[model samples]
Every structure is written in structure tokens, then in C-alpha cells.
Target: MNSIISEGVQVSVETFYQPDYSNPVQSEFMFAYRITLENHNAFPVKLHRRNWQIFDSNGSHREVEGEGVVGVQPTIQPGESYQYVSGCNLRTEMGKMKGTYQMENLNNKQMFTVDIPSFEMIVPMKNN
Candidate 1:
């Protein structure tokens, strides 16, 4: 797992290779990642948006920007955490992902960015 803290928010990520969902012969690889967002601030925070930079070992790169995550925006209270699982597909056996979350402080309505540490996804057999 990889974690990073910024603006009093902590982001942790764990990734899993999905063999059942991938077709290596066709150059399609699937990976699922679980993200946990922890609020270390004294007040609650709401996640508003997400931006991701995805890179593939085959030299493919893409950027994804969207509202919320996995569908709904969640508000995490102080000392609380919110978690979600999401999937990504790559044209290669290995890839990496990193992003940022836009969050709002519930107490002051101030917006801030929380960094999501870069995480790698590799096929189990490719680890060698």
C-alpha cells in the first residue's frame, strides 16, 4: 500500500491485479484499487472531484477528471475515513496511477487538494 498526506487529509491505496477480468492475449489488463481517505483535521471534509494521471508500460498515457468517486461524493468526519474500490484497464502488463482529490472543509467551506500517492499495478507473473 502507498499513502500520502496533504492539507490534513490522508490518502492510502492498495492495488490488485484482476486476472479474471483481463485478456492478456489481447493486450488488455485489468486492475482494481481500493482507496481510503482519512480526515485528520478537526472538521469534516467533503470530496468534490478527482483527477488522475494513468501511465502504461507500453507508453500509453491518459488523464481522467471527474466529479466525485465511484459515483457519489462522500463527507468524512474528523478522525473518520471513507473508502472505495475502483478499476482501471491498461494495454500493458504494468502501469502506474496517481491523482488528487478536491475537497471542501465543512466548517469553513474552503477547498483544498489532497494528493494520492502513485501506485503501481503489475501482473502477478510479471513481478519476476
Candidate 2:
């Protein structure tokens, strides 16, 4: 839960999740996450795309590379935060996700990277 800015733009990430215990046969796993980005500089910033590496409980892995999140590239003004609710489905019971965001500062004409911290997706051992 830590973030920093190189030139004035800041990025922060938080991950949340919910499990489907009743419809196990559906082979569906649900996840939720919120991404917050703040522009500290005088320029505006844009989040262009995402690259994710998802790891399951069985030592298996999956890659999800996509353009933007939820089909829209977000632009944030200075002192403002861009937040979104996004998710995925897993065939397995538990896993974790981590990735990076490609962002650009419009006013500076510079591009920088943002790290999306890895978060857990699981059904607690006590419940299992």
C-alpha cells in the first residue's frame, strides 16, 4: 500500500475480493480492486493500459494483457484521483494478481510506469 511519483504524478493500488462458495461447479472466481492515481503536478495524466500476471493456488499461471481498464483510458487532472472497480474470473479456488500500468503525462510529454501491487484471492483456511 505504498506509492511514489517521479515527476509529480502518484499511483496507489488496493485489492479486494469475494468468493463463490455455493456455485463451486460454475468454476467461477470473483475479484475486486480499486486503483487510485493522483496528479500532483500541473499537468494531466492518463492511464493507457494494463498488463497482469495471475497465479493460482495450484502453481499455474495466466497472463492478461489489455488496452486500458474496463474499455476506457482514464485521464486525471491535478489533485484528482482516478478510481475504478475491475475484476476477473478464475477456474481455480485461490490465486493472486499483480501488474503494471502504462501512464503518460500530457503536459510534460513524458511517460512513466506505475506498479500495481500483488494481492491475494483466497478462501480462508479456517473456512476451508
Candidate 3:
């Protein structure tokens, strides 16, 4: 797992390789990632958007930008947290992801960007 804190918000990530969903022969590799977002601020905040940069060992790159995560905009109170799981597909067994979340402070409606720490995804066998 990897974690990063920005402006009182903490983002942690855990990755897993989905062998069953991948076909190496076809150059398809699947990976799942779980994210935990924690707010340590004095006010509540809502996650409004997300942006990601995905890189594969084969030199493929992907940029993903969307509203909210997993289809819902969640409001997290001070000292509270939210978690979600998402997946990605890569053309190689090794890859990495990193990004940011756009959040709005409910107290003053001010927006801020929280860093999502970079994490790598590699097949277990590849680690050998």
C-alpha cells in the first residue's frame, strides 16, 4: 500500500493483479486498486472530480478524467473517511498509476487538489 497526505487529506492505495481477468497470450493484463480517502481537516469536504495518469511498462500511457469516483460524489466529514475499489487494464504485466482528486471545502466552498500516491502493479510471478 502507498499513501500521501495533502492539505489535511490522506489518500492510500493498495493494488492487486487479477490473473483470472487477464490473458497474457493476448497481451491483456488486469489490475484492481483500492483507495481510502481520509479527511483530517476541521470541515467537511466533497470530492468533485478525479484525474489519473496510467503508465504501462510497454510505454503505453492513458489519461483518465471524470466527475467523482466510482460514480458518486461523496462528502466526508472531518476525521472521517471513504473507500472505493476500481480496476485498470494494461498491455503489460508491469505498470503504475498516480493522480489527484479535486475536493471542495464545505465551509468556504474552496477547492483543493489532493495527491494520490503513485503505486505499481506487477504480477506475482514477475516479482521473482
Deviating ranges (above 4 Å) for candidate 3: none
lDDT by residue for model 3 over 56-93, one digit each (tens)? Answer: 99898999999999999999999999999999999998
Q: After superposition, how far is residue 69 of candidate 3 from its true place, in Å?
A: 0.4
Q: Candidate 2: what lDDT?
A: 0.73
Mind giving the per-residue lDDT tens digits that candidate 2 earns over 9-119? 666656555654324577666666666777787778888988999997778899999889888999988888877777766666787788788889887778888777676
Clashing pairs in 3: none
Q: Rank the candidates by TM-score, best first.
A: 1, 3, 2
Lowest summed-lDDT stretch of 10 residues in model 3? 119-128
The parts of candidate 2 lying over 4 Å away from their true place are 1-10, 14-16, 19-22, 124-128
Cα lDDT tens digits for candidate 1, 9-118: 99999999999999999999999999999999999999999999999997889999999999999999999999999999999999999999999999999999999999
**Full-model lDDT for every candidate:** 0.96, 0.73, 0.96
Model 1 residue 5 CA deviation (Å) reads 0.7
Q: Per-candidate TM vs. native? A: 0.99, 0.78, 0.98
Error of 1 at 79 (Å): 0.2
